[model samples]
Target: MDLIDRYIYAVTRRLPTEQRSDIEKELRGLIEDMLAASADLATKSASGPASDQTNATIRVLKDLGHPALLAARYRGSSQHLIGPEIYFLYTMVMKIVLLATGGGLLIAMIVSLITGAGGNPFTIILETLGSLISGLAAAFGWVTLVFAAIERFSPEKIKLDRDDIFDPLDLPEIPAKKDRIHPSDPIASMIFMLIAMVVASFVPRFVGIFWLDDPASNFIPLFNSAVFMMYLPFILATMAITLTREIGKLVSGRWTLGLALLSLGVEIPSLILTIVMMSNKDLFNDAIFTQIFAWLHQSDPFYFDLPMKILVGRIVIGLGVFGFVVEAVKTFVFWIKRAD
Candidate 1:
């Protein structure tokens, strides 16, 4: 039955991939046996085989309890920092945090390379790697600590009828078959935005280019630091708005009118800021441009000029605006279709 298959999927999904097939086999066998026993008893009593056994399957699943809890039982009673009741949520949060940390570190590395943060390329790379590892460890520890505190101090238990803790009506609606948002989409966006914010605001010096000719003077900062710093607040605000929208999407598990509106709100200001930044003459470092052009001239006998740089900046900004508009339109369309 479809319900049976769904039930099996729900349970097996919580398990490790390697264990899922074996556990599924065992679970299906046990369920079949239980159903057969029930059918046999009914048959003897009624002088015929049981006509409808779907209800029997439902009863079996209910008795087995929540799929997450059932999966935990199969995993055995090991002492855990977080209990089964909130284990799924804990894991999800950990995954998001870890992904964000990794992405942030990657951005930082790119920025460092471009900005020539350190005289030595190897040192910059090593420093970035170290930061990435430490950041991941810190994120993991913080998440575990938070979940552990919840497990220990929260008086509310995740009981089946825990109405006081949560309202049934507040639960997220199940998406229509064709309209479901893939979990990875919001997750990846959140990570990317988190990285962008960290690199842009806190580690702006890392946003430069590197050269191999002169080891000590190989890096060039992309932006005039003073000008970039002045715009940091606006940049950060846009990133924060987008980050919040992504988080909301992750929690709600789908796009909606509210999310689309929120996205538009973020995009409008972001687009404006993009225009302002691109138009400002102080945004680009003249020395860096000169150095890069000098290197280019030496290699190809072609000159890089102001108009070329302006054109490139405009192209980049145009692409960003185009992307924002496309996403906004898609979100609005999805929301409308879902509503209808």
Candidate 2:
């Protein structure tokens, strides 16, 4: 029975998502009917001994052929460039690539605007639109080409929809509800990562306070732009690593011990980078403190002095470490419970 369930899972998971439920029902009924027929035939024959249920099940499965072959039959025919075997993966890849492309281009536009490299707002808007269209087209074309080639030429292992050897025992276990990943989770994670990347890349240029009453000079940046630029690479790298982890989760569509470990691995580098950036005292703009004192029209109190800046940085570092630990513990605990 577990073998049958696994077999159904194996075959159905490879087919188009919309066709899976109906095909699964039909396949289950067919397998059951075949088993019943075999039982009746065995009874009529008065075989030397009762036929083994496992043997009968195996016989029926073998007679039906390999799961991949059966799945192909259910799919009917493939006239499209990408066959149904890998069509779902192809589409999913396309979606993720397009999203990444759009986000990267938007970040580039933000950087340009912040640095005054983009001349006029109207011109920048038009340029961004043109770039977005071209970037999306390129992403679509390249992703489609790769998946099409994989579907047409790659062996079963590479295509990920076929089995080298058809063994019901080797079929993957159906994931428990707690272990399953919802699409929204990965999508949201990716969106958050993109936003973080955009903000990190451009914050050095514009993160500050704007004065409402002062007409001459209205804004004071909070960070030393030069120093912030020096740390940009590490910040972007951290974001990229986390983004890759999210993509892995999306592709896997379930939590595993490996994925949990990978998340912790990614968190380490991210935490280290964040701590480094936060601890760098030279990165903050001293002028911001002066402006704040001027606005309050009072001498700097001890809590608002140079040591206060160091204390604030230490607090941020502590909070970051605590947050990382909480997330890591939660991920591993959930995965362990699900495994049980």
Indicate which candidate wins on TM-score: 2
- Candidate 1, residues 1-340, lDDT tens digits: the string is 6777898899999888999999999988888888887777665464323335776777877877899889988877454677787788678877887888788877777766655664467987888788777767866776677678666655454333244656779666786754555778777886777677667754447766765665554656788888899999899778766765565565556556665677677788888899889888778876776776676675332544545557667887998889888987887787778688
Q: Of the candidates shown, which would achieve the greatest lDDT relative to the real structure? A: 2
TM-score of 2: 0.59
lDDT of each: 0.73, 0.75
> Residue 262 in candidate 2 has what lDDT?
81
- By summed lDDT, which 10 consecutive residues of candidate 1 come out lowest? 154-163
Off by over 4 Å in 1: 1-91, 102-173, 202-204, 214-217, 296-306, 335-339
Question: In model 1, what is the error at residue 309, expressed in angstroms?
Answer: 3.9
